[model samples]
Target: MPPAVRERISAVTQKGVTLKDVAAAAQVSRATAARALNSYGYVGGETARRVLEAADRLGYRGNRIAEALRRGQLPLVGFVPGDIQNPFFARIAHDLEVELRKQRHNLLIASSEEDVEQEKELLDSLRSLSIRGFIVAPASATDNRHIAELAVGNVPLVLVDRAVKDVQCDSVVVDNEGGAREAVDYLVANGHRRIALLRDDSRIFTAQERLAGYQNSLREHGIALDESLVSISRSTVEHAVEATIRQFSRRDRPTALFTVDSLMTQGALLALRSMGLSIPHDVSLVGFDDFNLATFTDPQITVVAQPISEIGPLAAKLLLDRLAGNRPAIRNIRFPTRLVVRGSVLHPRKS
Candidate 1:
């Protein structure tokens, strides 16, 4: 054939070599060719290979429908987090974006605003997008069934910060229990015998874990756990501040407090000021996860610090690894935390 004629023939073959053409070329039925292409059960390996080779030789480009039915659409990895406005979650999103950019894969980001129904809705949307992998920070109210459904779908999922109970999956988390213990230990060592706990919502995994750590350390030091001194907030800075003042007005106020989060730290500071309490004089406070404003407080806040910038990259890398088919059994990665002592904590003063 002339060069131009040969080119035309090739072009025509490319255009015509759909499942119908592959079936005819391989001396098989169209349904069999489709089954082979889609990796469906009962298609003999030898037959599948022959059909594939024939399709390749014909210069065929598979249709979108065939690709979707066979292997799903273009690849995507998702990140679903609660409270996107929180600085912690924002940092996570930024790092995940950078990491995914390095791999040339797309990201789908969603927020649940700490609502259970919103979380479920976001998950449903991501599933519809055919995302094969996910990095999720479940809402405080998320249920086990919500997590189990993802597992059942065989999605490569990684939990960040908070994890679902009894659901096995890859996770990137901080040493919440250990960090809290360190914070409390520091306070006790400084002679804070009457320590209070300013807790975030009990429904949150981190909050509950940190509370356990606080209680454990108190018990270890022979300090009786005072339920009256433990205040639970809805994870809002305002609510925490109000609760702190209420606790402080009592005749028997705690000499020191271990706050659950940066936002809660703000509330504690406000309460201290409102009640004319001076840091380390009347009450001392320790915070979890250093915040930008920690240094600006009247007495700079002491904090248990996690490597926030590193957390994002680590979680993104785990999701990328799953997308690459490593599929090693679920991994649990815990990062270490450090205690940053500042002017906020001190020895208990004589009454």
Candidate 2:
């Protein structure tokens, strides 16, 4: 090649590889190069290969924004979890990323930290990226005007492990109420009436449902609701420890304890140990979500186990369907949770 030609090619490589540059390298028209790169229209076999090779050599990445403008969609999906650091959310994010990757799309994750305002801001910021759709676990089910607004704007949205009352979008959640009820019923059957609940923020939909389940179980069994036995805390081990300590510190200590999530369960374990309470002997324990630590304790912890593996894959499938212009009725899939009974609960001593 001539010095001028070589210099121009170097400039193109240094700046950025454009469609024109790829076309020039492949010795084809811009239109042909585009058709070949995008796999649209009729591209000749040899010419298509040549264009692809040139694109690869040039490290040519197409302008996503420009392509999105043309096609009215971007190859990006947003995931806003209640707390990304939480293992539950982390597992879902992994599944979502794996599922989206199969379709040549990317996942952009942002944590709401269980703040409604932060959730709204995340949605807005992601929207600015022209995200194709979103999978969000709304921070507060009631305070979700932003989520509703997104759905109203016809964005492909899916709610996972949580829901807003008025948002008619796809959702994948577990049967929190039934699961909690089962746990409490088991404790009651074991001759424990003074049960304590270590729960998360009431604004969260899961926490609300679980609380209802707890109350309903107590009422059915003719046990009076003890408001003092319920301790609300942020969904973290540290917060749960403090709440657990407070609950057991009172003179009228609970004979049994139920935690809302795995993090809280771990917290309860730490708190109980510090207070010289032994599992099954001192205080019977059951948690809502099972984790790795559940079985590792001296006496394995019993738990209400949600079908966590299914949640993210199902959510991704729903969002992808929406993005593909499938206008089926909005789906709300709530998977049943199982009560995994272990050595955590036993008959409580007379309280």
Candidate 3:
């Protein structure tokens, strides 16, 4: 550790060191010392070094929350996710917290549990706590009135994973459409014509985009769109399992299944297992959003992997830029997805 941080740690019981003392020791005004400490305003290099040395010798430690309040700002950043149960969102949240901590800011996380009203209430509660900005994955694309209000109020906000239709703001999202298309295209190349899609409700933006990509790929490959092969509004594992079972029980069952999200993918696997259907023997499978459990399955699942590691850091950088007074036009950054082919997908068996 540097001398300043080391001295701070050593001075556990000493409490008299202050900015005034540091300024006096450095032979500079309190304003100059403050600027040097915070790196807010322009200060001469030598002057900053001297002030830092004085602070280190005196063991002067600043209270970040108190300083932020004095400057009419909050040192807290808010992160609101639609559901924390999803490992994808949890990973994003964890990465975001790590990035925020590096910038000397505290992260406050709240879950909406995939409820629109609950999301609004959580936003309201976080706003009341004087959050500096927000990073959100919207629960419903159509019902984003609260998010719109945040933009209107000039609060720095960044959308992650999901983007609302009318609520324009900075966003960092994966290429859901392209990923879905790639997965479906891979299935088609494996000689699977009858491909079934299992997805969440269209209220969520990611689900909608993935569904569009699935449909578009089928159309591009000269496969007539079959509405009966698509399963929508399957939000939970139980719902997805039921939908998958119902679809497979049909006289004209699909040869392959493409799930739009992790939960639905797990459910589809369970449903296939319960029906005694073998992977790529009875039905090939492709899923969106790679997770740890995907690799541990009997035959590792093939999935469209989003850049989870980059998403959170990119979102944090956007918010931090806005906080630093960079008011450029809103930007929508869509990261590309990759298809990791494992042992799951294979050529369809002849009838």
Candidate 4:
């Protein structure tokens, strides 16, 4: 052969081997080689090796389209929160994103602004994007019907923080009842007989659980459950503060107030300060869920601390597990809570 012709043959053989040549060399049907190369159909173990080797030696270029079709879909995880601005939800999202990144999966975050309609709309939007899995903190007042649809659709989902009872799915949550009970128990032990319970509205699962815990503790300790001293406020700090003042302004005011959630804690503190009531001395205080400013308050607020970091990572792992084809029914994994006793909760002063 001429030198130029020889070089052209070498180039075709080495750098530009086609599928026809690979199929011929493999001594199998073109269909078989195509399947083995594109990862479409199953080939016998020995046949698969022969096809792969022939393609490798011939430098056969793969069909990118076929490869994409075989690979199926991109890995995606959705995270929907009641409000991304809320510190608790923000922390959860941060942890979830970090863990999901390690798995080479992308995260899609959305906020519902605590509106039921908004939550349903966002969920639909995420579904439209073909999200592989979900980590959701549902809105407090969300209608169960909307969430039920998501559950019945068999979307791999993990509920974090708050969850609806009928919606069966994997969940990671704090021990709300125990934490609230412990907060009130600590106050009662500190000689606070006239204690008040100010908590978030029961529209949320967590709020309801915490309230039940508070009520149980007070009733269990032989303290007459006074409805007048108990108030349920919205999630806003201002509403909590207003509720606190209203409870405190009564003729027989509570000596210690137990509020749930970090925002509510701030509200309670602000209410006390505005009323010129000193912490521990004038009125003892205990709140649930500690935050950055908890320790820096006038007299550091004692709190029942939820494991925010743990919940986020665990919820992510659960959602990923569901995505991985491990269907062990559904789980409700509840994490333990810790009571951090600080200066804010103290022994009531002698009248």
Output the number of the lDDT-best candidate. 2
For all candidates in order, the CA lDDT equals 0.82, 0.92, 0.89, 0.82
Over the full model, what C-alpha lDDT does candidate 1 score relative to the true structure?
0.82
Worst 10 residues of 2 by lDDT: 1-10
TM-score of each: 0.77, 0.83, 0.79, 0.77
Model 4 scores a C-alpha lDDT of 0.82
In model 4, which residue pairs have backbone atoms overlapping below 3 Å?
A: none
- RMSD of each candidate relative to the true structure: 7.6, 5.3, 8.7, 8.0
The numbered model that scores best in TM-score is 2
Worst 10 residues of 1 by lDDT: 1-10
- What is the descending TM-score order? 2, 3, 1, 4
Candidate 1: pairs in clash: none
Among all windows of 10 consecutive residues in model 3, the one with the lowest summed lDDT is: 4-13
For model 2, how does the per-residue alpha-carbon lDDT over 51-118 read when each residue is reduced to its tens digit? 99878878899986777746646699999999999999999999999999999889999999998888
In angstroms, the error of model 2 at 111 is: 0.6
Q: Is candidate 1 or candidate 3 better by lDDT?
A: 3
> Residue by residue across 1-351, what tens digits does model 1's lDDT show?
246534544665745656677676666788998878776767887888878876777766777643762365666778888887777888888888888889876677888877778888889887876777888888762465777789767788888998777788888889999999999999999998889898876767888789989999999999998899898886678888888988888898888999988888888888888878898677888999899999997679999999998888888888788778887778888899999988998788888
